[model samples]
Target: MAEHGRRRWRLVLTASPLQGHMSPMLHLATFLHSKGFSITMAHSDLNRPDPLNHPGLTFLPLRDNLSATADFAGAGQFLQTLNDNCRPHFQHHLVQIIDSQKEASASEKESIVVIHDNLMFFAGSVAADLGLPSIILRTSSASFFPAINIIPQLLEQGRFPVQGPNNQILDNEEIVSELHPIRYKDLPFLCTPIEQTLKTINMIITKKPPSAFLWNTFEFLEPTGLTHIRDHYQVPVFSVGPLHKIIPTHSTSFHKEDTSCISWLDKQAPRSVVYVSLGSLANVDEKISTEMAWGLANSNQPFLWVVRPGLVKGFEWFEFLPEDLVNQMKMRGLIVKWAPQKEVLAHSAVGGFWSHCGWNSTLESMFEGVPMLCQPFELDQKVNCRYLSDVWKIGVEIVAERGEIEDAIRKVLVGKEGEEMKQRAIEIQEKVKVAISHGGSSHNSLEAFVDYILSL
Candidate 1:
């Protein structure tokens, strides 16, 4: 409680030590901190070395003794490590952190609310043990919420065992009619029929139910999917998006380059360059990497491609790019390991996005009103692709399978249909801009959400 008898909300947000999860959650944490929430953001010391910076917010680092390779493979391995190595010890460690904080100042102590990324499955139990409210924060698409919430029902309906050879299940209209439009591939790999996987996901989702599912989206950007979630979940779903706007960084965080990319973009025509990144998490294999490199070279488009060293499977394979081809693309494009994504997307030169369909990237692209060449690798990506192409009409899917890769890229870049998609992207961008304005739905929802937290 504060001077005016206002309750100071104490919140602990824990992330899964992945860049995508950490980034947006940090944005949200900072936004809440600005609104006067007492925040303690916890990260695995192994992943995020430095503490998150925000005035009045404390950062706690936990040692995750598991092998680093666990996160590289996929979310399945990550969840298994969480269940086997992290979960058993998390509650005790969390209490210790809370106790340490409580001991520091008498006035600072209150019932701590836990906000965790989806992978932090044991948090609900941790919150329960501490007699605090827990909320699940997903940096992924909100449309997936209704589907995730109904996993048990999907399982009971015999959908799990019917997966096809390539991990896609044959589409069944009857099954699709009942649940949110989630394909077998779109579900997290951890949500498998294997007894342990099923049990862990069930345990986690059932406990938290996402505590008012918050997405990095705006209403008009994907109205149908938003409506679907509202109709299905019957719970408070907050779309506080173009998240970059709510929590804009004072400046970019540069590990490799200074702010040189913006100057390069200034010379190009508006909507001329394609911004390419598969996000920090998705590892592009050598073959696909080389193919994409070749396709970009062949298209003769001015582009900005972020090719971080370890993002491709192996270092030696990067040498496979023919010297001539590399030089040619360089003349027409800019290639770097990383860039300030929000800055780059907002630039005038950025015409489109060639994305892996991660929700963070999707929202960033939406924030800029840039159309996307949707290439969803796995998990909720397929669902995101459906929403972007079918529901929102903001972009077109570049590849459903490997064979469609080059064609999809060409279509989105130079084809007449691609031009139409660009117009749709601009239209949605305007709608999103309106939604976050002073009297907009998202603006009201954000204030309402913060007010509710303050009341708690």
Candidate 2:
């Protein structure tokens, strides 16, 4: 009964089972859905406790979802396991779903187009098998793409670990400590464990096509990196971002955290509250979490903290805070387990952010012109933090991790040095806003990318 050769090719958004991986893809899915593209977002039944429900976007649950691994450990182990398990199961599940969808929609000749996470290596094969056009959504910086794509090859070629005395994979401590310009520490956390990292990279190198890459950065921010990818791959790579533009012109509520958090911000003076959140996916061991809490408590500044459930390690640790500090923070601070981040960042009361320097957080903060207190954790965060401090001059890093957190907060919040960073951040915010507005690079790239997708 369907119109011949005129069927809409529904987009299937396939993501790895992590919040950081999913959020930006969902942001794009939301955009495509708004533009009237039918979207079926495939998620791991193995992961979500409560699956997302969007009106236009269909959430298709897969049996044997890759996220359900029996060997789940702490955050570090879990991510590595996720990296390992995701590829095989996702690839298998994708083939099954496509075959099934094709049968059901057989009357219509239109096939599917997959917008998949770059980390999901299996999608490349599945796309080819089904003769579907697949785009690898590189949600991280374009600057990091070459390093990411070549990591496995580099290990095979002996380009990295150039000067280390030991086989870099064997010397765990040496890997974290040595390596200049970008240390193993600065590398994405997975790269710190070189053998394990090589496994992940091998998957990428073996499966990815030259023309399949799509990054979440605009030309203005990462022209050199994008150029590097193109020169090396000899394929078209798209950079369409500050995806924030496609989000509702007015924000929508996504998290169930206390709404009062916004009201508290309303009461605070404009650009006065320092917002603190390490993206939902990253977890600090108890020591750093305690240090951060004490640092914030001691700073005595108004703050809004997003403490996602289970992000903190130990319950007993919260008792270390003096009751007086807790009272003071309660009066001046708003602590929610999860937040609608884009909304909070866009709010007038938020002056700066204390971030873990995840790419999404970094881009969103930049897009909002919110300066960062860069406390980088694993992975590409170190590089993202460096860009903030060295390239953009919109943030500062804490030199001494142990005792300097309080000083870092005070410096970004109220001190004379803080004033300079504050002004620079606001200036950057204006730049970001303009770039995403009409006639901006991101805007132009977005239209072109959509056109490409539509053409397929």
Candidate 3:
């Protein structure tokens, strides 16, 4: 109700306390705000966005009582801590938001909607208790979201908790559905105990179904997964993404991004440099770090490598690079604490990415049409690498050995096979550009999402 037919829709959004989760959530909020909706973002105190940095959007930090260091333990522990400690704070703030909306005058009163990241299951509960329309945003691919639903079936079939010597169960691929062909290795939390898997399953199932599902993936990228989710779920599913392409924003890194890498890339030949980064959370042990260093040096190709602090276990920063490897990297490679990833990907010199296959990095590389050398460490990274290598043919996965890493780099950077992979990536890039433009699938889906929120 508005005095002069003015729109007064307000959205409350919450994301899990992780860099990957927060980045996309911020982008979505920015997009909605641009579309004439007022936005309020509830975030964990750790890694909270500065409210001053984002005008017209209110930022509320929930007291989770956990330090930022909690993230280093891994995804399972971080998620468990959030669920255990953040619920009361989240609920209390949500009630306050609802009360504030109710207190407004009739014409100025806003129609409140809640959008929460899939990992923040508690937000959904609060939304339901308050009778607000809630939308669950799966920041990863549509494929990864449905996989969690079938964990119990996998457990019953003795396919989960991937037991036995060296986890032999992961070696065999089973068709979960006509849409999803998965191996045990692609499942997240595979190394964790069955109790952890059960807890995740229970958490997902116990939540009341949201009004709709929002995915940060395009239709062409995950057709079968999208189809399966749409057919199986009762709510409407919207696939409107490569979110970065749709709404380009500044660097959202918890650490500072070194833009000097762009200047370094300027000196390299077009498509001759490989960009390597393992993402925010994936850690490489000392041995693997050493192997990677030598492998990159041996590749003899120009590279821009981001060696973040705490990336190597039991060592500080770039201390992992050996003396000999440092000499080799002198002219051929540039190592920075962190690089502006999107800028690096878009640079002409960068041809392939050595990445952890985090969904954000995956989408960014694809959008920029750069081929990838995927070294997925955990979580949805494995599933995303499967799609990149097996489904899309835009990238290749690397084995942990130094020789394999060196070979993968050469294959992607200078080999004839890499040219064809680059072509495929370019095609995907064109399709993504079209999808985010006017009269495209993702654009229409986003409009539909807005319309649904208005109707509510």
RMSD of 2: 4.6
User: Model 3, range 199-222, lDDT digits (tens) per residue?
Assistant: 766765534578999889999888
On lDDT, the candidate that comes out on top is 3
TM-score for each predicted model, relative to the true structure? 0.84, 0.82, 0.94
Q: Model 1: per-residue lDDT, tens digit, 1-456?
A: 221153345678887766677777777887888776777777665466255345556877655676556443545556656544555555766677677775766555555678877677666667777777776666777676665665567577876545657876554323355444545545554334456556555544545355566667777555666787767656677778766677655432323443588898999888778888887667877778877887777666788888876877876235667898789888888888788888888998887898988887888788688889887776677778878887777777774343465566667767887788878888877877888889887887788877656555
lDDT of each: 0.70, 0.68, 0.82
Report clash pairs, candidate 2. 188-379, 188-380, 189-379, 369-429
Error of 2 at 121 (Å): 2.0
* Model 2 local distance difference test score: 0.68
Candidate 2 or 3, higher TM-score? 3
Highest TM-score: give the candidate number.
3
What tens digits encode model 2's per-residue C-alpha lDDT throughout 299-397?
777888887766766552245456775786686677787777877888989888988888888888877777889977766687788678867777888
> RMSD of model 3, in Å?
2.3
RMSD of each: 3.9, 4.6, 2.3
Stretches of candidate 2 off by over 4 Å are: 1-7, 47-53, 65-70, 73-107, 149-184, 189-191, 204-207, 249-255, 320-332, 399-403
Off by over 4 Å in 1: 1-6, 52-55, 70-74, 83-111, 149-155, 160-175, 179-200, 207-211, 222-235, 250-258, 400-410
